[model samples]
Target: MALFVGLTGGIASGKSTVARLLSARNIPVIDTDLISRELVEPGQPCLNELCQHFGPEILNEDGHLNRKTLREKIFTDSSARAVLETILHPQIRRIAKERAEQSATQAPYVLVVVPLLADPKVQPHYQWLDYVVGVRATPAIQKARLLERPGIDPPLADQMISAQSSDRERDAIVNEWIVNTGDLTTLARQVDQCHHKLLMLTAERTSSE
Candidate 1:
């Protein structure tokens, strides 16, 4: 079995950037965010359940999920957000686990990017992960990065940031930390160092097994 590493961070904390850096070094990654998107495709059961709970208005005229509309609904309503998590989290976890298992045969280790890994409700479900790596950035940096994304404004970005686990919370659970408060070059160096550490850990685990 390969070492299963869970990568997590708050929105705009550079989780995706770190994942990309790891991918560039040829590490296999199973991203729950991508799996979540796949689970909600028009005809998927998860999408059907979402419509049942949130109404058909959440879907576009083309019958696909109107992500913006759904985001607006969930961000404003805590109950709605919990409902969304209830519907998608289990499915995403299952699929991500399956993919990680498949990738283990082809790589020294596998990275599973899960943005909510520090959530009290979400963290317990991912206990099978061998290690957890938290990517962190200052609130100022996070807000700036979030504002750069399309359709995100200051208020919405603040709401998104406030909804996630804080750096201290993440630090409590993460086996390793990647500080992402700097430029790409600095971030890449941290990733390189983390990658080397993971490789060594993987080799140690393999020999023991």
Candidate 2:
């Protein structure tokens, strides 16, 4: 089985950067966010369930899932959020498991990156190594990173970070961390080491098998 790395981080915290570095090394990554997006396609089972749970209002004029509207509703309403999680999490896990199994037979290892890896519940079934890789920047630095993304507003970005676990808590949970403090070279080096460690773990398992 491929080593399942559960990546966690706050908004604009460079999880993508670390994932990209690993991808550049030819390693496979199972992104839950990507799978979540897939499950909500217009006529998929998940879409049907969501429409039933959330009503037809969750659909766009084109009859596709209106992600924007759904996200807005879920974010503000705790019950809505719980209901959506109840609907989406299982499907996401199912897709992730299938991908992980496929990857295991094809390669030595694969990473399952979840944005909210510290959610305490709903973590993947794989023996996932939680990683709290992120930018150790001040609030101003974080705001700059968020605003530089073009469409993000400062206040919303602030709220997004505040909504999740603190950096210390994230760091405490993960097996390792990659500090993205404007030093891309250092970040790249660290990710390299971490990637090999993951590969080594997978190699060990492969040999045992």
How many clashing residue pairs are found in candidate 1?
0
74, model 1: CA deviation in Å? 1.0
Q: For residues 84-171, what per-residue lDDT tens digits would candidate 1 score against the true structure?
A: 9999999999999999999999888899999989889988999989999999999999999988888889999998899888988888
lDDT of 1 at 182: 82
Residue 102, candidate 1: Cα error in Å is 0.7
Candidate 1: regions farther than 4 A off? none
Candidate 1 C-alpha error for residue 43, in Å: 0.8
* TM-score for each predicted model, relative to the true structure: 0.97, 0.81
At residue 25, candidate 1 shows an lDDT of: 85
Best by TM-score: 1
lDDT of 2 by residue, 1-209 (tens): 55656676766677778888888877788888889988888778888988888899989899888766676676566688888888889888878878876776666666677777666665434344433334344556667787886545666566656766667766656777777776789888888888778778777877899
Cα RMSD, each candidate: 0.9, 3.0
Query: Who wins the lDDT comparison?
Result: 1
Clashes per model (N, Cα, C within 3 A): 0, 1
